[model samples]
Target chain A: MKKDMRSGFFALIGKAAGIVAVGAGLGLGVNALRADGLSLGATRPTVGDDKSTAGSCSAGPTTNVPEASIDEARALYGKPGVTFVDARSRADFERGHVKGAVLLPYEAAAAAAGQASLPVPTDHRLIVYCEYVNCQLSSLLAQLLSQSGCERVRVLKGGYPAWASAGLPTGTGP
Target chain B: MGERRAANGDGAVSESAATSGVSSSCAVTRFLEGPIVQIAARLALAAIFFYAAIPKIGDPAAFARDIANYRLVPEEMVSPAAVMLPWIELVTALCLALGVLTRGAALVCAVLLAAFTAATTAAVLRGLNIECGCFGQSGSGNAVGWGTVVRDAAFLVPAVLVVLFDRGRYGLAKAIKRP
Candidate 1:
């Protein structure tokens, strides 16, 4: 009886291993065939640098977008040619945002890419931000804006929360 | 005549009473180990995994971003995990729902649930205000919190039960094995 139980346990483990192997194989195979598949070795774009891993497998033209520190953004604040673009949801924007920041939520901007005019002036330097550093919406929006022919685009390093925490100027409204 | 003699024999009544008690308990155990309970557990887990897999499969890039937000995986490995995890969930779901390799799929589901629980718990402790990314990138409302940790932990019960007690009854595995 003990032998039978031991064998049963081994058989179950073997089956589980087989399932994982098959699943991984199918996943890699399918991803390879898809157009939008990501390259496995690619690194996320780092702050303050234009060096970014080719994001997708297709290896399209890469964009050179940098991230700006809070101080740098503070320096640029209220400048004639600089604009702060909030990439968070409309609700988040309404709750609070960087003073003078224009609300352009990431999802809406992505959907309207190539068709709609972005809220910022074409010639203005743009600084994009979402909730925090880990949030990707700001980076994604910055990329979209750069791809849409915005000359100078930068993601805010720590995002709106970081700016607000640093005692920077802020506002709350639609 | 012989049976009556046995019933009336010394200790026979006590033996019968003991036998009745054992059988009643056995019946409850048998019902729990039966096909009905096993099938329900298997199907419920299957539905959840299937629902979670679909959106991630459709948008792996966004899914990768979500995974990166967790900050658990190294940046380079994030893409591969994001690409493969949805497929694994999908395959396991299909197997569980179809009653094919039911035990194996249940084991995978249990492991996945454990990992998710751990990730969410870590996020909560660290106070990272981010989406759970349990379903997909658009899981905007599924924030990582103690509630998310509890939900993933709760899912493990059915998954582990299916792994241990599933006997392949009413499953494709049995049919496929038949010559």
Candidate 2:
């Protein structure tokens, strides 16, 4: 009886090992087939970069804007076509923000982007910024704006904190 | 083969003893090993793996990036893993769902679940606040957390159960050749 139990356990292990081997073999075959036909190496645009939009989609060329320092952003404070978009949450936008920055919270992109009375046109420049350097919201918004036909979309360097530290114009609520 | 012999051996022992307590324990084991319960466990695990694999298979690049986010696989190997893992999942899911080689399929599921649990646990401990990426990247990603580890651990139960009680009455494995 003892011998039978030991052999049974071994047989079970063997069966499992066989299944795993077959599964792995099939997986490799499928992967090879996919790689042969498709271009899988194209990397998506990551945050914190200065490059023109690759125009991988239907929308025509939209320049990927560079990260702007506090000084550079201040220069655009009163520029005619530049718009500062707050990419933080609504609560954070309410607590403080760039004086004329409009709230376009990253998660609420769809509703805000779909608004009929959005301040800027598709061709206008959008300056997006979030909490700080580590935050991804600003970069994500920049990518989304560029994809949505915006002519230029730049992320604010150091985000809102750097701007606030420079004593640039600040506002609270809405 | 070995499983049948052990059952026969147990039968002989139980008959010789004829004790109420031993017989009751055997009865409970038999109930738990019933075909209906085993098949249900197999199908449940199959459904989860299928759902996870289908979306991932459609976009290998996105899945590759998600794998990179975990920082577990080497950068060069990420692409291959991204391409292959989903296909393996799909195959194992099909096997479990169809009850073909159910023991082997269950073992695969158990191994995958164990790996996921380990990865998710490590990510949480390291404070890597990234998407769990169990499924394909969605609009809002699930953050790596203790909850994710718990969920993966819970999934292992069905897989382990199927592996143990796989001699269930209903299955392609039985149809092909009765053990």
lDDT of 1 by residue, A52-147 (tens): 222121213447679999899999999899999999888888889999899988878765655556567657888999986679889877876766
Candidate 2 docking class: incorrect
TM-score of chain A of 2: 0.61
For model 1 chain B, the run of ten residues with the poorest summed lDDT? B1-10
Against the native complex, each candidate's DockQ, computed on alpha carbons, is 0.44, 0.19
DockQ (model 1, Cα): 0.44
CA deviation > 4 Å runs, candidate 1: A46-81, A86-126, A131-133, A137-174, B1-25, B137-139
Q: How well does candidate 1 match the true structure in TM-score terms? A: 0.72
lDDT of 2 by residue, B61-164 (tens): 55665676677876567776777688778888888888887777888889999999999998888777566779875323366789999999999999998887
lDDT of 1 at A130: 92
Model 1 over residues B81-174: C-alpha lDDT tens digits?
Answer: 9889999999999999899988988999999999999999998998887878899955354678899999999999989888877777768888
Go through the candidates in order and give each one's C-alpha lDDT.
Answer: 0.82, 0.73
